[model samples]
Target: MMTSLFDQFASPTMLGIPLIVIAVMLPWTMFPSPTPQWVTNRVITIQMWLANRFTNQLMTPLSLGGHKWALLLTSLMLYLITINMLGLLPYTFTPTTQLSMNMGFAFPLWLATLIIGMRDQPTMSLGHLLPEGTPVPLIPALIVIETISLFIRPLALGVRLTANLTAGHLLIQLLATAVYVLLPLMPTVALLTAAVFFLLTLLEIAVALIQAYVFVLLLSLYLQENI
Candidate 1:
């Protein structure tokens, strides 16, 4: 009757419908819609401030053309952060821990940047494959290497997010199991294990926020290169 640690990552269902659909949609309702008022609540104020700051920081490195993505990227960032933080709650599934979901977000955005670069500035886009001043002997090798690196970006993005969240979740479950088992036999050891579990939970919360930010930030960098 014991459950596997990774069983928590599996998508739950209700009436045979995947609960992930609900999990993804639930975060959107957590935010309040903007109101037309002279003074807004503190929640609205703080949310606006965070959005502005994040957008500014994310767009600073890119050209004006990249500014067009400010809305899309900002919205995606908030959605991701909300999902990640919510997943930390009890009985919740973290969809980002799944490779398919992470890649669903990563690949299309990465490809869009590449397409924009190719469409608007084909020379510069292709030039990225081979740097200037390369020796004749090294030209083919360098081009092949760069080409492989370029295609690997999306895979790296998806795997990085999935790996980090999955690892954190697994460690947490292992520690929790240890604490429970130890409590029945060794009180002192159980207390120490519990304390470590608490700290690791806090760290996981931060990791959730950070991984979401890093995902969006990398997307922006890819866009910058294209723009």
Candidate 2:
């Protein structure tokens, strides 16, 4: 029974081909491509509006060098949002919930920011390890601590996304199971549970959107520091 609860998280396969690959690629098909018309349809207009707004907001805090990432970050934000929201549908697998996949998304991007810092401004980047005006004795220990924290960023990014989505999914499943089991035995309790489940579903939807945004937002912050 315990094992059954987590079965949904197992990667689905067909004749040894992983369905995760399909899931990751599916979101791209949902967006409508723009036409050559001078004025576009409402869907394309809204897409343009949202993309412009997000790009403007994200680029606000960034330096001119960092502005180059605006397009990549905006597209990533949309992709994540679509993927996360789609997972909330019945019988769908969320790719972001897997640690390995989330790490794949996080590590390379995190490393890119690190590389930019090291290559462009090695002194300034290393200086981030030690605070200004530190005591002679504390410098070594602080540098070591900062170094550990630096390396841990990607791990933290992956774990945060995976943990939040996993926990929410598990709770929703438990509540669903409770509703199903209690329906005949205790109609009133089951009704209440179903109501709670409905509310939780809404919250989970919000969480899906927020988590995607937070993931991208953190990447931007990392880029800000480096650039």
**Which one is best on lDDT?**
1
**Would you list the clashing residue pairs of candidate 1?**
none
After superposing candidate 1 on the true structure, give the runs of residues whose Cα lies further than 4 Å from its correct spot.
none
- The TM-score obtained by model 1 is 0.98
The TM-score measured for candidate 2 stands at 0.97
Per-residue alpha-carbon lDDT of candidate 2 for residues 1-227, written as tens digits (9 for 90 to 100): 35788888988899999999999999999999999999899999999999999899999999999999998999889998898888888899999889999999999999999999999999999999999999999999999999999999999999998999999999999999999999999999999999999999999999988998899999999999988
Estimate candidate 2's alpha-carbon lDDT, on a 0 to 1 scale.
0.93
**How well does each candidate superpose onto the true structure, as a TM-score?**
0.98, 0.97
lDDT of 1 by residue, 1-227 (tens): 98887898999998999999999999999999889998999999999999999999999999999999999999999999999888888889989889999999999999999999999999999999999999999999999999999999999999999999999999889999999999989999999999999999999999998999999999998898888
- Superposed by TM-score, candidate 1 places the C-alpha of residue 207 at a distance from the truth, in angstroms, of 0.5
Q: Each candidate's lDDT (Cα)?
A: 0.94, 0.93
- List pairs with backbone clashes in candidate 2: none
* Residue 45 in candidate 2, Cα distance off native in Å: 1.1
Cα lDDT of candidate 1 equals 0.94
